[model samples]
Target: MVTEVRGFTDPQKEEYFRKRFRDEEQASRIISHIKKARSLHIMCHIPVFCWITATVLEDVLETREGGQLPQTLTEMYIHFLVVQAKVKKVKYDGGAETDPHWSPESRKMIKSLGKLAFDQLQKGNLIFYESDLTECGIDIRAASVYSGVFTQIFKEERGLYQDKVFCFIHLSVQEFLAALHVHLTFINSGLNLLEEQQTSSQTEEHFYQSAVNKALQSPNGHLDLFLRFLLGFSLQTNQTLLRGLLTQTGSSSLTNQETVQYIKMELSENLSAEKSINLIHCLNELNDRSLVEEIQQHRTSGSLSTGKLSPAQCSALVFILLSSEEDLDEFDFKKYSASEEALLRMLPVVKASNKALLSSCNVSEEGCEKLLSAVSSQSCSLRELDLSTNSLKASAVKLLSAAVESPHAKLNVLRLNICELSEGNCEALSSVLSSQSSSLTELDLSIRKLQDSGVKRLSAGLQRLNCKLNTLRLSGCNLSERSCEALCSVLSSQCSSLRELDLSNSDLQDSGVKLLSAGLKSSQCAVETLSLSGCLITEEGCTSLASALSSNPSHLRELDLSYNHPGDSGMKLLSAGLKEPGWRLDTLRSRMFPEGPGGSSVASLLFAAGPPPVCCDLHRPSPTLLISAVSAPWGLVP
Candidate 1:
């Protein structure tokens, strides 16, 4: 008992054009032209726009020159109007339709339909009852002509509960017709209905200012396109297409310039993101890309960093980023201005990108609320987000974590390294890692003060069966032996999925390494890469690690013991495990600090564990085998 209808997707849009033209080359030509005007191609998602575009382009391509084809939305609507009028003449008079020859009767009917559209549009009514039409002074019988070519006026087949109702094929058509009526009334009588309170002043500025204000006041922005169409009428080009319907086709060029300035200045005001984007669209409709072009100039010149971008320029940058065909990749905030406001204005850009690097911009708490929408957006392609060096509050972290735990989240990698993370933030992220819906596989919370408490909280999540994390980085978290106990539990658990662990630059002295060795020896441990660089380890710590390698060396493929004072005694113990009969560790990475005397002997003997034959020369130490860089897997010690 329920029915659903939706607009065309990209494939469906192409399919409609292919089916309508029935010529691959012809359809491709029309498609190519629309694609160049990105805004027009976006609108083709609607079936009604596609139909109207086909109608206008079909004749334009055949008769009109290259630049004569409609580029903006308003121009396209105007051409559709002229085409529909000419079709009416041909269908009834059986005459060769050279141009639109509007009879008095046809003009009267169209004008009446316009009034009906304006009246219904104000009340936000898409469907009209029989009484609604009569109230607008529209003769029900005369309205049927629009059904033939205009595609909508009275769709009697929509028998909702056996009652006659009327509506446009699309809401945009109604808005366009309504705007047409307003333009006609204004150019003819200098009357302005857009103004809530009528003023004696009839300046062009007053008319457009009132329209913009009214559009901004609407809660859901229902009047945005209507405002675009209304302002677009000021241009002489859009007006010429409706010359037959207008009392006068001529418009003052000064008035057009004034309207453009008024709307462009509104961009400097503190408007919502939605309002800013709509204002940009209105500028496009007015054929004013001066602001956008100016920003493009500054961007290309590489002088954007030398000066602060104004709010108008910032919005234009957002518009330019979104308008490009190169979406669905990555958005790096550093490429644009480092201003937080400008970065936040680019939510739509982030929504389309698969990866986003928003590091070090110092996003505020309120900004995190804005980012929550993008993080949780089901339609967004965002898979990886790096918020490194952004000092986020615990409350902001909670909001982001909740989104990461949502079923709609597609986020796979989150890097919060050097983010001033706290225990409270760790608790929030722990929930995300434990969530069944979470897709997070890699996490970096490096260079913070998580200590023992944060690691314990995180260990709970890592031990959960639903946790998807395989790579975890906790470098410079100020960890100690207490932290090791909690992580050891996670490493030995059957539910843990941890494969790569980084504890570099933490103060996990000999005691911590012993507890970690207990976890490493467990048969359930799946860790392939373990980094313990700059952990203040000693010979005692190396002894426990040797036993762990001897007990279980099948899983550990990479061991990093760079920057530690493992003396001759520790190297003697470690070499026994590395040379065990069932040894499988191929990537042996160790950096030993000499103790007392004969430390060089210990360094040369340490290579006996697993280095290649070239690196195993005891007489000369190979530079390739003595890597101390904890930045990555830098070298191989045998």
Candidate 2:
């Protein structure tokens, strides 16, 4: 789908103006003005946009003494129309600068062109024939003048058979002109082209409401930009720029605010991400930034953590993240609010993020349905998902299991910790991991009560050659040696890809340690980090571990034995194992012993195992290994 048709660079744009304009200072001044306006500068990249900018900015800068200047898209297009008319008048009609730009004849021509633009745009037809022009009341003779006055705006070309066909210079030009046509039709004659039904009391609010409805109903969002321009034209300053086209300018400010309010309310509805983002754009065009500004203020002051956000603010925050160009490496759901409604409202962020952190958010089964859509979607960027602590049940996780088993999904890391899983949930997870399509490398099921039965189910997946899991965390899972027996099978299997295993805070006594050490000595064991901290292990466990390390301990780099009953005797076994020159243990975390000579000798021996073997002081409260599984802040677009 990609083509070599990228727009002009900044230097190319400046060079374009310099070549078009005879006076270099004037060209420099115009480039300076375009640079000041970020949107305008970005638009100048397109070659046709450069022409439109040249036409619009040249006149506006010269008439710098104007009553009001153009800023929004609606205002700029309005000025573009007026400037085209004025140029035609002076060049061909010998009119002065002070001449009334919108003569009756000029209005006729522009209105006809607007009608053509609107009608053709509605039909999704960018190119039209002469017959199509006549339908919009543009005779062949008037079309000549149309091509002459705004040749670039309304272009003429030959078809395959050498017959003449026509289209606007760009699709954006057609959309802008169509929006102007809709706005002027409503303003001058009170005709609602969007809807066939006319209410008894059709205020500016209803007309705009109809326009919004029509745009939202378009399946492909064909009228999205047109709707933005149409709504933006409701602003009073933009109306002033359209003075030549308007016959009525007395729209009440109260009614405009009502329309803005209506748009914000629409934002809170359960709309698709694309529609929600477009509605936010419409709100911006109306100059209503109250919701957006409030969210920004909350995020800036760290007050979002303290207060609850309304539905509208949640949509605004989503708009900020979805529309940003920054590399949103993470989307933290709980960072905003833990409300289930907020999580559901912002599910679109999951599809947009490289890694989404939705753990600990007050998510529901319905939220899982929404999350499933995002994850299974073919174009989503989500690779890592942390859905921990939402307290979801088996049925909810089964829904997520569907996405995890899909070949198209790119999910690589999944954290379902503390989600209240049963044996059935583990069965579903086991199937997902066993699927050859699954790409998950790290699975964190920590803090769950998946007992021996559940661990047996997961062991089926760990033994599958198709399963590619490298890090498996079952910390605080109420496991016993029976569960460790199942894991021992997995660790000894050459098919197991597990390099890191966290079985911390378990009831795995010496029996479990011995079971695990037996697997660690397997030539196929790839585990580099093993965390058995707080497990009920004493001297007997230490003897087994030391003997296992003495035999084949090259694969085991770091071992955690903290907060256990591994007394002085166990320490001596560990110290003896450390003194062995065969193994290369990088980090060893054991209990902090008392200050007796016997305890000091064991401690110093374990520490001073002469080439300064890697060790860890279990005293410093295990440097928070994870970053709350939540990070990467968002901001409001300026």
Candidate 3:
């Protein structure tokens, strides 16, 4: 009945010198596996700079610490460079070189580490979680172990990715500034690169060479290397990647809007009208949901209206308006009229193919209804229909009722934001929301005059709705505790598939928050993100929230409570929950405090450090708070 000893032995567990050569080999295998997993995470990000940076850093650290480099260095390095080469091929003009040959030393490192790591994986003896906190506050995670080197290196590489992306944007801004010099000092500099190219009357290669030479002769007025690089990229790239870089680089500097404008104009000047149109279309095609969302947030209605877009850019605008339907429920349409005419003109082109585009055209009931009906009859692919600021009386609600119930309804997004709808309309819209035809994913009813009675009317309809409606925004909806109770009841019921709920700018205080939290505690709530900005709740409300978050919980990953003025006390209360491992919060972004010195706003306090593993961002008000505030457990200062 005696069990055979098979696991790691005491000799292997002892100090490096105490272990046999076999034990050392076993430990190395474990380290190697961890390095491979870490490498996957790093390789996911493109442009091998991060990997290169990590390798160089590892080399530097090895030099300083007088230790051997990790066994998997060569494999990680090659994988990193391969990613860079791939991204470069797609992003850079003239394409990137491949099959780069590493040195013999590198090859040897790869062969040695690859075999060792593979053997460990095959043996199934790797420890994925190898660190824990010691008695002192300092985390004792993998910092001293041999594998700790690669883990440290991976973190540094990830950090390098962030820094490099940030620096790339900054360098782009500098290039824009260099281009701006053309408008200031260089406009009449007697030497224009474009003009020089046009009139040189020399061989194309020689002329371009001279132009590059002249461009780089002096930094005083010359474009920086980044700009030169950008020009080269645009000249040799295909339509898609070029357009992506143009949109990204152009939009990076929102503060320097004028500079961005100039750069776009300069780039456009070199292209034909057709190409410019396609470029604008490509910008509209930016399908990276995250980046587009960031842009939508920063660029508001007023700003968009004032921004200049040529006739060719209109189709792109139409596309954005169309795609916006997917989440029109969250938008505040009143803020987006930017030259109503420009928006109106694109509607027809967008609606040309939809027979249901202009349904429910009863102008007598409400202006919004008439517009909705008129568009319903058209044969256009109308994805988003914005009627936020209009009086969408009972008639408009009824129009939507039909569209939502019809199985063939093409409408996926319907925005009724800021509409002054009555209780009757709410009930009617509830039917629409519950209908099988509605493919709505996002619905923003913020700033609507919906009272408790309205919510009560719609609760049943919401519970029965089968649409994949993940994001629900109801900011400033005049919801009371009673309304919250009813809503919570629905959420705890069968309709528990929601992912995000934004209840900002509402009248709900601690009582409402408590009720919502209680409902969320139910097993039926599958929400992943929540927002309660400007709810006027106190620190005590946060205590209730913390309690709910720390409890055996749901899938919540992000929670935002911006503009709530909860102060330090409320923040501390939330921090308590964050310190607990039970809490599943990942992105806790908020802008709660006032701006600090150098115009740094207090919103940056949300990401400030405390005792938990979290990212503190105090940059909204100013990044200076990280310097001046008392450092907390989250790693951010107040």
Candidate 4:
């Protein structure tokens, strides 16, 4: 069972084997046997011809240095590869397999010997078993030197075909390396969006250890280089692993300032602020009170108070710190004690940066007011404002609207989500938006009770505003089909440059979706990403959406109909469009039951269900729209 095979190198021996393989109709038998051999730590399913060539070379090396080969074929394979890359006119011969450098028969015999050796190793899973090459008649000193050179060669060709067996234990020949290679290629090339499979901390640690082992084994005395490579790979594969650890584990691994700097240096190129935000959420879960104390205790705490903040909390605080106005009454005065003062002192650095965080902070009304006052200075350098989920009512909007016209209005984003804005606040905000001096790029008005009337008033300003507003979120604004029509009309007109729209959880039915679909057909419309999650849509709406998508397939990049009741018929309609190669829609899924695994099947089930009350007419647009052009004729313009 533990047979060491020597590959046949003689032309006659090759012919015999080839003829025998042909007779048996086994084109891959020999290569398969070699791969199944357990001596190789890294298995690359090379072409059969390559394997034959490798077998010949491995045989020649063994004969020249009789009974003196590395213990693990992993070590010997690496040694052989180095020899192949460096040497020319390799010669070997056995009576059965021959090469010019050895007798034809001698080369054949050596090749057979090599095959037998590999087979023997495979039978026993010898690579995992063997550690000391000296016991196996290998020159340890020479093998060690050869390993260094071999590692260098391996690194140079790391891109060709990775030895993933060492990287992941689950790798099997059943799994296609080329397919995985293509995936990693796509990711490295940045051609497609790739999401990492979420894994638990223990799993990640296990994988990390494996990665370390692989890197260490990659080359001799190049552990640092291997570590650097692993770091880059880990970031690419699932940077969240590192970020999650930092967040959930607190500041244990990164307590040393040097270590923090090293992590920052390692991740600086690709660690985005968004990743930082996730880190912050994790850190927030960990008690940052110690960090708070640490900040208070430090002499130069101002410059390093941020050190008290984990990478995640620091990322989250970017919003709180930069947007806090000097005159605001809401921000806890106590919070402003030492750390806040230190952050304010660093305002110059913050203001100079282009990054801004858009999130809802659940601070009290007084805290919001205090925050506004603090940031409401001539010297205040707030570039973006997000008062979403705060009590920024009509009065607050009116006051902030003045800041929109201020000479130092560095504001490019404003979020007023769930701020309970009525028509009065809508009008006030719209007036500021319509102003010639407005520098806003994104505005979020979700869950703000923007009924038909308030929406209608805002529509007027939207039509007049010349600013480059790209994203508008009005989810749960009590918008009926008519309100969607109004927004659709604005989006369809020349006045809109909106690239993203989120009407999620808006209670809109098929009629609203249809109205919006028709608007998308208009040549002037530029909306690219659309989210209608939780909207009540039926099969009819899917048909309408398919038509809209067909009208302009290139513009849309992402569309989310998640949580919508689009049953089988609707899913079929959408799937037809999604399968199109020209359409920019990269992801599509739905949740009809709100409990089942969300997928196309669920989407189909949702639409198969009857249309909601808002789509009572099924054919007619909802009556909520003040604009009349959308309802007439009963169908979208083709």
Top candidate when judged by TM-score against the true structure: 1
- Cα lDDT tens digits, model 4, 1-638, are 22333333223333544554553433244433333332221222223333433454345444564443332222333334334323322321122323232333322322332232223322323231122333433344433333343332111112234421111111121011112222233333432211244333323333433433333343332222223222222322222322211212222232323323333333223233333322222222221223323433442345432234343234434433332222232232123222332333333323433432323444444444444444444444566665666656566677777767555566777878878678888788778667776777788898767887787777777777474678888877878788877887777778777898888776678988888898888777788888887777778888888898888777876677665666667766666565567776655544333333333323333334432222211111222211111221222231
By lDDT rank, best first, the candidates go 1, 2, 4, 3
lDDT of 2 by residue, 1-638 (tens): 21334577667988999998878887787777766554456567788878877778778767874434455556677778788878877887799989888777777777788889899988999999999998998887778778877775787778999988888889888998888888788777777888777544577888988888898899999999899888887888888866766777746788788888888878777666667767876776776768777877888888887667777788888866664445578988778888877777777787878899987886778778877877987757799999888888778989988898876678999998988899999989998888898999999999899999999999999899899999999988889999989998998998999999999878899999999888887888889888987677888998888888877867877788865667777866665555456666656676432232433322223223321222334222233221111111121121
lDDT of 3 at 156: 17
List the pairs of residues colliding in candidate 2.
none
Candidate 4 segments whose C-alpha is farther than 4 A from its true place: 1-379, 594-638
In order, candidate lDDTs are 0.78, 0.78, 0.46, 0.47
Kindly state the number of residue pairs that clash in model 4.
71
When summed lDDT is taken over every stretch of 10 residues in candidate 2, the lowest stretch is 627-636
Model 1 compared with the native: what TM-score?
0.82
| Tens-place lDDT digits, model 3, residues 473-511 | 787787877877887876677664578888876768889
Global local distance difference test of model 3: 0.46
Better of 2 and 3 by lDDT: 2
Taking all chains together, each candidate's TM-score versus the true structure is 0.82, 0.71, 0.40, 0.40
Order the candidate numbers by TM-score, best to worst: 1, 2, 4, 3
Candidate 1: C-alpha lDDT: 0.78
Residue 535, model 4, lDDT = 76
